[model samples]
Target: MKFQDYKVTDINLADWGQKEINIAETEMPGLMALRKEYSSSQPLKGANIVGCLHMTIQTAVLIETLIALGASVRWSSCNIFSTQDHAAAAIASKNIPVFAWKGETEEEYNWCIEKTLSGSDTWAPNLMIDDGGDLTKIVHEKYPGLL
Candidate 1:
């Protein structure tokens, strides 16, 4: 999906979430080291990744690391209630596509998952990072051709 098509609860909270992400970056030494080590080599270069996880400050750090490693990414929350709006906003502010919000209904949750899976042929995700099996299950059920 295009970045403009991303569905987030609020874009206004980006600045606040960005501050939290900055703090989280400082606490995540291992991921930071990976960014430093692989940024030049770009091991994940040309990879497209879809991530389904809790959209929290910590997850933001992980997402940023993936970008640093040269992967393009789209993200959605694994749990409807686990999303942190500010964190989603922060990630989205960087032009990364994010499809999630706190307190989503079952329909909205599924919709977010679909958004993560939707993209142009050139932008389609080749890698998946799922904390829960929901995203995988959906892919298996609805887009078996991909599997």
Candidate 2:
């Protein structure tokens, strides 16, 4: 896991993150219900899900859903500039490992993707949820077995 090569601020933005998470939760009733019902079932109990998407209300819904379904998630921004810092905060507030933020430098963007893939070393995702296909491509090229 090249995680050591990446530099994350690792600071707490709790209040800001909480606000975004709350708002996303309100808009995602369907995913939320899935979380409530299936969480205990643990259908995805040992699964790992690495998602590359914009940090937004919709993405928050998806990540929380996957977690509730018993999957460990590593989230990253798809487009470098599209990440909403507040939304990233929201996801991070829940203590879901997120590796993206607004106005990230190119190095940060690549590093985040590297971190997401690193989580797969132990157990590759059974399924990947991606917005722009960057994560998918990386998995294919670097760890084709996941595909």
Candidate 3:
């Protein structure tokens, strides 16, 4: 996804968030190993993934790992108040379209989920990873064609 399409709280925090992601990569050996094992095969090649979860440092690592395995991804935070802005920034910096921020209103939260579902004409997520089921609910209600 284009970097400009992302709607994160801050782009400036990317450096800090990237550092945290780097640290997390070291701590998450299993995911890292999976990346190393499958990157060449690209098992998820051409797959589009939409993820709704807490926007945290650990999640950043997971997002990057997904990319490494050859999936295109769009992400959103499950809870408006649970997003780590820096983590959002970092993921966005990598050109993974993200629609989330801290303190989002109800309307904003729904908007974010919509964005994740219909982010790009070239990429419509075939796989969903949702935490609180909001993403699933919205997709079912508004974009049943996807199911």
Candidate 4:
């Protein structure tokens, strides 16, 4: 995706989030190893992953690892309060669409989920990763063709 494609809380928070995401990367050896091992082969090269989870430093690490292993991703927070704006910004800075922020109403939360599930003209997800059932539920109820 292009750099201008995402809708995060703030693009300016990228530097702040990058430092933490860097620290988190150091603490995640398993993913690092996987990235080193499989990145060249790019087993997930064709993957278009839609992820709905808590947006945090840890989540950023996972998403980046997925990218390193060759998966294009879109993301959203499962809960309104669980999203870290800086983290969302960081992901979006790398041209990965991440729709989330620190606070949201029920409607906003659902909207973010829908954004991850159904992105801009350039994105069409072929896989999904969900924390709670909201993503799955919405796919079944709304975008049944994704099934």
Find the candidate with the highest lDDT and give its number: 1
Please report, in order, the local distance difference test score of every candidate based on alpha carbons: 0.91, 0.74, 0.90, 0.89
Tens digits of per-residue lDDT, candidate 1, 7-35, equal 88999999999999899889999999999
- Return the TM-score for candidate 2, rounded to 2 decimals: 0.81
RMSD of 1: 1.7
Sorted by TM-score (best first), the order is 3, 1, 4, 2
Error of 2 at 33 (Å): 1.8
In candidate 3, how many Å is residue 7 off? 0.6
**Residue 86 lDDT in candidate 4:** 90
Which pairs of residues collide in model 4?
none
Report per-prediction Cα RMSD to one decimal: 1.7, 3.5, 1.4, 1.7
- Model 3 C-alpha lDDT per residue in residues 15-47, reported as the tens digit of each score: 999998899899999999999999989999988
Candidate 2's residue-wise lDDT over 49-100, tens digit each? 8888887667877887888788888888898888767667666656677888
Candidate 3: segments with Cα more than 4 A from true spot: none
Each candidate structure's TM-score, on Cα atoms with residue i matched to residue i, is 0.95, 0.81, 0.95, 0.94
The candidate with the higher TM-score, 3 or 4, is: 3
Clashing pairs in 1: 1-119
Candidate 2 ranges with C-alpha deviation above 4 Å: 1-10
Which structure is stronger by lDDT: 2 or 4? 4
Candidate 1: Cα lDDT at 14: 96
Worst 10 residues of 1 by lDDT: 1-10
Error of 4 at 27 (Å): 0.6
Candidate 2 overall Cα lDDT vs. reference?
Answer: 0.74
Clashing pairs in 3: none
